[model samples]
Target: MADLTGKRIVVGMTGGVAAYKTAELVRRMMDEGATVDVVMTEAATKFITPVTMQALSGRPVFVDPWDPRVPNNMAHIDLSRGADAILVVPASTNFMARVAHGFADDLLATLCVARACPLLMVPAMNREMWGNPATQRNAAQLRADGIVLLGPVDGDQACGEVGSGRMMEPHDVLQELIAFFQPKPLQGVRVLITAGPTAEPIDPVRVLTNVSSGKMGYAIARAAREAGADVTLVSGPTALATPRGVLRIDAHSARDMMSAVMGETPRADVFIAVAAVADWRVAEASAQKIKKTAGEPPTLSFVQNPDILATVAALPGGPYCVGFAAETEHLDQHATEKRQRKGIPLLVGNLAQDALGADDTTLILYDDQGRHPLPRQSKLAAARELIAQVARRLPAGRVPTLAARPAPGSPSAVPSAPPSPLSLP
Candidate 1:
């Protein structure tokens, strides 16, 4: 099933150049199985025609407050009555001021005022307008009134100037909408995760690394963030973009990963060791590039790397540890033994062939209760399920202190001091 299956959304557009993005948003929403109803203000219609929105939404666009389409002529009330949420895309500074004061002079504002569902606003305007003292006050008032604001992120704007007050990209907006509907089981929890494959340098010109693509770990990071955890990812080299609302630390080798993980683990409530760390490294890596010989290869000795999970688990009063075991065979035995060996409460296991570099895989959760296998599914879906399992297993009465946790984009939300930068071979 699609993520938003059976969900009903009301997409409200105000006057702004960002209205073009709303067209894509509506199409993407429908692609995710959400039934969308497009609502437009008079100013919005001037920017993007109602016919364009109607074509994208597959429903008759509503722009007039007194349209005869509604049986009772109350489009504002009827349109939003059954909606799960009303999302105002490209909400202009003027519209925000009107809504902030409860003015319902227009159809979209009237629907917002009459809506029973949650209201989410995406502010899009000039940096100066957004930074205006009055606009700031209005924003604060809207927040106080329980309206959710997605973003007016810093970036290039349409007015040939660059600063804050740009609408979030359509994909990002969709992600936020999806997260809004998710269960915040990890609210106020601090999660530390390691992802990708740790590289061991054989020489300046060569490195040994597994085929692990870090998809699962990144997915878990995103899921944890969506579940309201303050997530920090210690990632090895990977081309994937950092998940929204996640702090990322770069790690190249096993030692680099270990250092990063240890530094952040003290403040973490949960530590998920998901990186495919190399067990061994070159005993003595050559300072210069090793040249290829005519017949024989240069001999190299290896030494075992520090066991990151075991070390962290061994720490006194350390975070709750979770380990992953990618086994070529006998996953049940290897996974169970690994969990016991590491002294962690939970272990996730999967077949190496099924999981490495793959987007979908079967996962088995091994705990004191026994092994519970999750159906093969997308990494994100599996990650969400794993987070749910972890939530259930957490100590009772571990109530979320959401207010105490740093809010996203706040200075405190970032790592105060990052680990030393890794110099990759």
Candidate 2:
């Protein structure tokens, strides 16, 4: 998420040996297309030269408040004008206390206090200095004043004695900055997502599965997390790493997937069925591997797997259902029919050959308003678009509970508190 394109940032450096790392931070921000302005305190010059930072940032670094650089002689006020954000990298304990106490002793403090932009503080100091009670109170006060703090990560330090109080790597700091700029489109929404291809075992070694790579699903999960949703990913077998901040549940077969989905769906605000589940599983899977006979191949019996999407959509007051259709031909017809049949509000369709195990996709979204084609793009971009679409279509408030179904063979029986078992665990 370190995509800082077109952003204007002021990177502030304070007195700390960790100021050496601030050069990399400024370089990285510039690499991400951000126009960076470096501001250094007097003590900061001892650790890293302003000339080095000026070369990296390709701009004059600010050192003195009255250095005659600004036409108005208000360098502190003019510097942050039109700026999107201000970052205090390698924020020393002294600077933290100064910012916390609103002391404008120098340009960094003056600009930070006078700026209208969002402020982020990246603390870097000795473990003892960071752990001091005064520093802790100052940090707390800054947080109370709505200042965002990145990290003084735990690791080996310049002083050679380390537990905590090391600056976060430049890449991580950029990621935090990116996240800060992202819009929380899915805030307070609980999303349950299914990903990958479910296996239907025929024997210990033989099974039926598909070519799904789970890339799209995982992308969607990551997008949802970025959008500030509480996400739970119910996944079949895949080698992909879990997205940050997403709770993942592993399921190997269609049955296991159903169980996991059922367990989590009730509390979800949205449910996206992206897993390619086996249509039929072996009725009685062999305990041992089945050997081929010389005369003929062994016959196998099959049974239908639970219809997870349809079952969830049919439930009383169920979450908003979104189904995926991977069709070889007649994509529109199949996608529309599937959406209607499953009683889902939205359906995403793409060619099986184009999407299966592929990073880029051309998606056709089917919904109440009709079909909309999204041009081919990377799965991550597509996922972001999809999340935006869902956020727009979400109801004003929670959907009202549906009328309860009558009990079997008893028309007058009262409704049960929970619906009947859709799929056995």
Candidate 3:
């Protein structure tokens, strides 16, 4: 069955350039067999004409509750009565605050106040407004009230200022709407993921670390959670916020990360190794910050840190382990070799330069089945594909994969879809 077929969605548009996108969103949702009711705020009407929306929806766009032409002037009440969910695209700071306060001055807020269905608000505005404490507080309040805030994507904005606060694209919002109703296929599973670059302390302030920003691992954790898994994310230092429902364990150095993962890995049903662990640490020295000597330079002995992926994969009663191979050159060869050497049933490989810190990546998933190239997509979308692939690889009735014999990353390794993409976005 189509997940969103015949599903009712109420889309709220506010005063922003993004409001124009809502008309397209309405059409797309309809294409997916969704019945969408457009509710436009006064400010929203300034951006997208009610006539245009009405033509696209083939239904009157709800603008005011007290329009005398409408029966009993109850347009707001009737519009939201049977929605499967509500999506507030182009949700402005003003609209957010009103929703946060249960203000019903506008038709959109009135509908939200009266609706019992799931509430999803996609906030779109200037980055500064988005970052303002009051706006953030309102968003927090709305979330706490069971409002699902999708996105105000980051990048260049209509106002010429940039940071965040752009509404999610129509297709993305539509996909989210579809996924919302699908059966949680990976439900009841427990996932443990390690992400970001593990630091190896040298001098007091100096440390060894890579360019990893912990995007992939954390995205996996999020995807697993959305699929109904209990996820524990063991992450190294990074600027990303922890996803909802994920238990985040902070780690600094490779040793710290190893200890944390070792402690949690056993209980997980699936373990994905995505962290770029520092290869070596200072053997000894530096009780305080090392001073730059006026002479030549100082030398420090280095010791290799434990290979976290290899260690975790080898555990007798461990979770089904997955590893990542990030290479600068010969990406496929190295990833395949790492996959075999690490003894993981699955390995996610990608180019470090293109995949390192960017929001988009193309992955080559290596396994007994061979390598499958997953098209470049946002980290969030890639995460979903990876979760689904993991589910398929695992044995039926369990989240563990069936035994597969392979030549170990051999040139003839079975190909599937590309490995999951990770991004700091």
Candidate with maximal lDDT: 1
Candidate 1 wrong stretches, greater than 4 Å: 397-425
TM of each candidate vs. truth: 0.93, 0.80, 0.61
The digit string of per-residue lDDT tens for model 3 on 1-425 reads 24468798888888888877888888988887887778888888888898999899887777777877667788777777787777888888998999899998877888889886777777888899999999989977876565667776788899888788887788777766665554355655788999998877777788878888888887787788766567899899999988756899999998999999989986888898889888888899478998888998888898888988899888886778788888989988888888889998999888999899888788889997778889998787788788888877776544442223223223222222211111000
Tens digits of per-residue lDDT for model 2, 1-425: 33688899999999988888889888988887899999999999999999999999999999999978788889899889899889999899999999999999999999999987778889998999989999989987876566767777899888998867888888778766765666656655789999999999999999999999999999998888777677899999999998756899999999999999999997898999999988999999999999888888888999999999999999998899999999999999999999999999999999999899989999989998999999899898899899989888877666322123233224232122211111000
Candidate no. 1 TM-score: 0.93
Global local distance difference test of model 3: 0.78
If ranked by lDDT, best first, what sequence of candidates would result? 1, 2, 3
For each candidate, what is the lDDT?
0.88, 0.85, 0.78
Question: What is every candidate's alpha-carbon RMSD to the true fold?
Answer: 5.9, 10.1, 11.6
Residue range with the least summed lDDT across 10 consecutive positions in model 2? 416-425
Runs with alpha carbons beyond 4 Å of true place in candidate 3:
1-8, 11-183, 400-425
Task: Please provide, for model 1 over 161-254, each residue's C-alpha lDDT reduced to its tens digit, 9 standing for 90 to 100.
Answer: 9999999999999988888778766767899999999999987879989899999999999999888788999999999999988899999999
